[model samples]
Target chain A: MISSSRFLPRVSGLALFLFLVVPAPSLVPARAADPAEIRIGYLHLAESKQQPISLLDEPTDDDGIAGARMAVEDNNGTGRFTNQHFSIEDMRLKPSDDAAAAAKSLIDKGILLIVVDLPPGMVLTAADAGRASGATLFDAGSSDDSLREEDCRANVIHTAPTRSMLADALAQYLAWKRWQRWLLVTGSHPQDALYADALKRAAKRFGSTIVEERIFKDTGGARRTDTGIVQTQRQMPVFTQNAPAYDVLVAADESNVFAGYLPYRTWDARPVAGSAGLVPTSWDPAHDSWGAVQMQNRFIKLAHRRMKAIDMQAWTAVRMIGEGATRTQSADPAKIVAYIKSPSFEIAAFKGQKLTLRDWNLQLRQPILLSDGRTVVSVSPQEGYLHQTSELDTLGYDRPETKCKLN
Target chain B: MQAQLIRRGRIRRWPPLWLSLALTVGATSSAFAYTAYVTNERDNTVSVVDLDKMQTVKTIQVGQRPRGIVISPDGKFLYICAGDDDIVQIVDTKSQQVVGDLPSGPDPELLALNKTGDLLYLSNENDALVTIIDVKERKALAQIPVGVEPEGMGVSPDGKIVVNTSETTNMAHFIDTDKRDVVANVLVDARPRYAEWKSDGSEVWVSAEVGGTVSVIDPVKHVVTKKITFSVPGLRSEAIQPVGIRFTKDGKLAFVALGPANRVAVVNAQTHEVEKYLLVGQRVWQLAFTPDQKYLISTNGVSNDISVIDVADLKVIKSIQVGSFPWGVAISPE
Candidate 1:
């Protein structure tokens, strides 16, 4: 009985679709009486061998797409009474595939709302390709600050937090805890360098001092060898030895190099934060407060696993489209995009408050969660750190500092 | 047990002549206070607070995760929605003990009672159904399907209609009592958490926790007539989540519990304008009124305390510490 009631709406929708497809005039309704159909596209890169250091952090095959599917189901739940129906088309691109071509193919099929989980360069290519088609793309993967700044695209909406936002969230908690001195350890990768720059900016902005800086080269080694635990236990302490006095050791290893080995393996008795210990993220599996338990449970039930940060970003992006369509009561892509860009567009993804789009940068302004792999330590945009307009704006770049100028 | 219930109901209806005359003659205005029962969601207990004493007098344990609470019209029993247990436990007010349990559906979050208080209506959050149970018979008469994540239930003053608010669906479903089915669904703001009807039955107000607005709907037309937004000078708009709403006896003022804002907004019901905000404990979740309408109490979930508001003066007078995570409250008529 439970499963039947749950599927009844879709059954009726399918029946209606069949009725409308038939050539019989008596079964067809007037144009104004027909339900509005909304279709969304999800484009994500195929699975890669680059996984997190921890075995428990492996990404599921349906990670980002699963979240989009959940939002589509949620949208249909509301659409049943509103005379609307939502569907999603998912496309997985290989490493060598052209993102622009994949996006254009989806746009050609009348799916004007696209959610992209790709690298920064690929996101720009897909956005540019969809520009002529008037398709709106949601960025749900990349955290590169340049994507929201100098390299920003006019048609792209970013649900993923920038590196600056994550760094600032961690910095604010550290400042609140009165950990004013940081010993910064950066990886050799280019993405790691960008994250390190964001951390430096946050340290200066939040009145913290980086006492000393060190580098941890990747050196091309296997991440999970039999002797890994013993080697890291002895090597990490010596590598981090004799640094200038600091309250905390902040890591900038976005490439999953060495941050995970710094918690108990540090030479000094200090806490670790940044990309590993007490990391900042958009969502965590342990988050249960603020009515998030239901959302977590629903996602787990659908995906058969715990939700991840990327999943949450994809979910928010799809939910934004759903909110826009439901509010405007129109499936026209132009109208939906306009409504989403307006100041009235606010969506609640169990974040304790409604999240709105930053009109200037098109970034989703949200509170970042600080987690320690097991449970949520705290949420950012902490108390007493106020902005003139919004506390969420205090984390990322404000309007005055924006390098983005939408055409 | 039936005879005992009847005798207990009759004695409460009419006080002894000598006691009534003594109460009327001595401190008539000052001593008119009632007992407030609060359900602590985290502790799985209810704290019995005496209004006159301004403190918790006793604690009665119940089932797991008790949230929504309501008192009978005769003030003889209290119905507690134990969400985890999936049953509504009945507590005899006189003994302050669990007497029976009603067959509520899964994950009951909030509930409503009819005007005569014989029928109970509760929203099953997990099943998306409004299970209407016969209170005296302790059986579910009907389970009416509704939108997703139905959390709030409100009945009309005339007992003809009951409204259930679905959080995810963002709608207020009006269910006909006689027919036991949804008559109309009014789209409201996002994440609608609570529904309240005016005493005159003209408007039904639904509070949206995420959309941060209260939509006032015309019951006859089943359309939203007005959307009331809240704003505080220092707080951001998102933090001003309006949850539980209560109206005064005269229907002039309305008190809305602003969750996480740590305040209660007093709105002019006639003009639909916010008059003032009264600061209270942290994460105020629900509210209840004293029988005499002299004081209003708010449950602070985060602070684990109840703040008492002097209704006429519009001031927070006292805060009484209760069990952990005090979520729902109901006061006796006496």
Candidate 2:
């Protein structure tokens, strides 16, 4: 642990002196080539909102960080052959903690790659701080479209699927099922409104119509109490009673306040989709195709829990660092970032395909898994949904739809 | 079929991977009692299938997780990797029974034989080692350290350089037999599980099960020259994972087992163009051709059967039921 700033110069001199005194052998190339110590930093929110799901679906303390750690283990497994060693530093910030201060602390320790698992506001602050320090930032949690759109940071890459991507995935599946009419219900949260905007954009792009838009107001009440289920059972059906006829009820509840209660309690007896019944995500626990069982089993053994999309996103962000280092055979962040932004960069994340980054917004191009909580129903970028370049382009904002001018 | 093979470039070499392939082709010319050995991974048994009759004559119980299978150069014995038991079991082809065992390290998954047949190379998947055993002494020789989860082994025809493909590392490590050390590491796609040398020995093809592509490497240069892609209609592109690869005797054609797409891609070896996709059983893992070149058998892991394809017409002639999760396949010239 070279902690003292004054001793760093002496250690450098000693390293130079040792290099001159000793002749390095050629037999062991692994030692000769491996001089780089690639370190990554993970910044996440210390206090997150309690997600209301079944007891089996509760989040863990190391939700995003655990996935980043698992990816470091995976990277080290392959780093042995690539002649590189990887390490990750995890920093958690309180709700009142300044994200830029945490970013500065990580940068002070010589971390050039940082994985940010925070809300949209915090993601911006960290990205700004990381950019000034010549560090590359990966957004592993924020799904807000503006981060990849008008407010896109030049140094930030997104492994998390945008709201537009998720909405597009759901819209494509709905259109494929000939469910053109949708009864849209959105929560009153700001994030929920942003998700609704993307859902509207998807409906327009994919030839679907929102029959009516209804806002589910956040009447002040605690939902985790024992008497909440009975209240939800009576209130939801009556709330949805007077809606127009529609094929499916699409919910945009990013706040998780009401979507989980809409499935079996709908008044129209229609299948509920979008963020609830059949959700479009980067990964699901039931995803067991294309040799994903191996990855899932590996995760279960390590984390002793089911892998969520956040975990996969964080894992991918760190694995990208390892992949870039291995490909370029250098620990330089500039070189790694350049190689990652190139057209030839790709990494397999048990998604049944090699995922590439859209050179336009640096968003990862991946197929979305539409899982129904228990089993994977199907994957999006569905059959007939085609694009001029890649079918995966149809599931997200394409190159032509970008206003992001990264300076 | 019009094979649209695009040749990237011709690799030059003298007497390449063909020495063993040439012998395999020559052995097929005679009416030898050619037998095909299939390793049933989940069943922990070895199925001795008669190629002429296209049937399993006997099922010999081996250790747990019997995967990689290879016939001895003399054509009398068969060597297999029983992964969970951490040992390599030898089977007498004539008697169709487990005859002996080799001192392999932990979790042996795949094996290969040198041209001289004096040594056997087996991959210890869990330990990331390539264990070499001297056949004459029946003793362990050396354990060469490699990348993580090394699963495939392919020895050069000249018995000089041995190739070990690591699953997690996604690299083809070339080890020099003389020094018993890794000479070079060539990065392939994700989860490279198997490697096969071209008949002329100019190139080595490695299959990446998760990357859904095959990397063709120049053995001398130790770099991937071309990446082979596949397109099967109605099959999701991600499902076209190439696992086990085998080239025909004349080096004109190749067969790649697509793990879950339930198909095998037949390609023109020279041009690297996919000629056809032959629909087979579910989760086809590995493939082997009879010495007579009359039939090609594929082990379907999920369906627990072997699909027999007539090599002449490239059609599935029959699907024979086997034990659960049939994995590696090796044909005998006895």
Candidate 3:
């Protein structure tokens, strides 16, 4: 019982099938050539933190991955015309996982273009792991100035605004508003300390004077309690009391320690800015100009949450890759990276400008949005802040100040 | 620096009927009149500007968010896209009132009409669909899915092709009219908001609002043949966002409205070069040419006014306050 008839192909049957199918392939040679497939990896560290103000303000489960997916969809839509297809591999690593090892695993899986949503150290580790193979890593999470300075890597392209850029954006706007004197308040955390340094540098650059510097020491208290608001209201005003009069109060609380308690709770009527109140960010929920509403609406419908600054950073990184692929008509990671680094490469992230990568540091140049948690108050590099190359460059560390070797 | 151009031509106060008739024939043809219509986005009204008088004659209240507008081929009716109302209101220009509504999709941002005026191609910006409706039937015949956030509609001169530009997808989706199906898609720069085809239909120009470039594409090959870049001495490159493009009667000159830069880039159409940037109102959004091609009106959104430019000299002749946000403009052919 070998079932000999099943294995046996009749001469007439085989000839008829070949006759119809073989000519079809010959008739359309273009169809025989498959579309160029671009594979991207999104690497994020699995972590969570207590959102200070509202429970609803926390990052969603998808978070950075959702942005990558949207960018892939956007790229695929544009890619279909050029006979290119885009696919993303999302890999989230635990706190204990090694970023370098995880990056290697993704490389083994045939992903050379990676969007990293990791801490600065992990982003560096991931970049180091991929550099030997000419892999490109887009840093969407960290805003450390050192990543674009002493610790810069040729393989890493930064999409997130650096601490210097954010600080300068606020400083320029504050200068425009004639708030030239600042009462600088910084948290005790290392990240906050870095932000404080950037703010100081910005103040010096913009001719703004820091009247006094106060460090808000973190005492490790519960963020949300029945009596927490009462305690915070009493503590903040007293802490800000008896300070010399300043035009504005600028905070450097990147660690989410106490900046949120400064607005309206200050001892004086002066406004709070810089990491809180009127903060400078890559993207905000209230931004709706220059065709941003469409982006916001699409993101809301897809992710069921408002897109955050980190999400926009991740979105921008993936879009940079997508823009490169669509423009160059290539799926090769090296070609994409080269095109991105070239002066001709520009990507628009609904920022009312064509964002380009800086040749020296590979940092994307974009306008920073100053938001008051409700609406975009202003955008900087404000009117008078001019630059030799681009006004956007005026907000960040320009070419002359670069310590980056890009090796 | 001037508030407006002061070109006071001698007024022939109350010319005789015979002399005026002769002058009208000389200016236009037998008995034609030119009327420029501007859609006011925030006020939900269409301001009817009289070219003969150089002022707004009447303001017809349309509905919520009236942006894209176009006059019929015979110049009897005007189609206005009231975006929030989700209906394309048909207004009888003579009556100065909405006569009916075209069955448009979810959100119609822009509309394109064929040569015969038999079909209307509408771009549903929110839904990513292009609805083609029969003008006579007043019903949609085809709802073709296009790229994301379709905002610009361009119908080829031959009436064989319709090109729709999507903002988010950064593409021009080409639909073959006979089949009413998408035949090809061409990738353009980011946030393409408007598209215009040459008179001969050989090529199409698409304006990218965010990419800050205008891509001229070959209709046959569906590829960008030339990319036009603009530069004004003090204007930031990012602010030179191209939108609302228009070409002259002979196709020798093209006028591109540069958003936020507040200038209209006068381009040499044949060479694909920017000849000059004429300063206009803030956030210039759309452009319209009078039938005689002697003047061009640009809708300035941020300034809430329209700058009328003398086409021959590329100078701003007059700035007329229209409404809160003037987004789209159209003119009736004399």
> On TM-score, who's better, 1 or 2?
1
Query: What does TM-score give for chain A of every model?
Result: 0.92, 0.91, 0.91
Q: How far out, in Å, is residue B63 in model 3?
A: 2.8
Greater TM-score among 1 and 3 belongs to 1
Ordered list by DockQ, greatest first: 3, 1, 2
lDDT computed for candidate 1 = 0.87
- The total of clashing pairs for model 3 equals 0
lDDT of 2 by residue, A302-401 (tens): 8989888999999999988888998898889889999889987888887767788988888999989998999999898888876766788997678898
Model 1, A248-300: lDDT tens digits are 99999999989998999999999999988999999999998787877887898
DockQ of candidate 2 is 0.23
lDDT head-to-head 1 vs 2, winner: 1
Best by lDDT: 1
Q: For candidate 3, give the lDDT of residue B197.
A: 94
Q: What residue runs in model 3 are displaced by over 4 Å at the alpha carbon?
A: A1-30, B1-33
For residues A118-213, what per-residue lDDT tens digits would candidate 3 score against the true structure?
Answer: 889999899999878778899998999999998999999999999999999999999898999999999999999999999999999999999999
Q: How close is candidate 1 to the true structure, as a TM-score?
A: 0.91
Q: A-chain TM-score in candidate 1?
A: 0.92
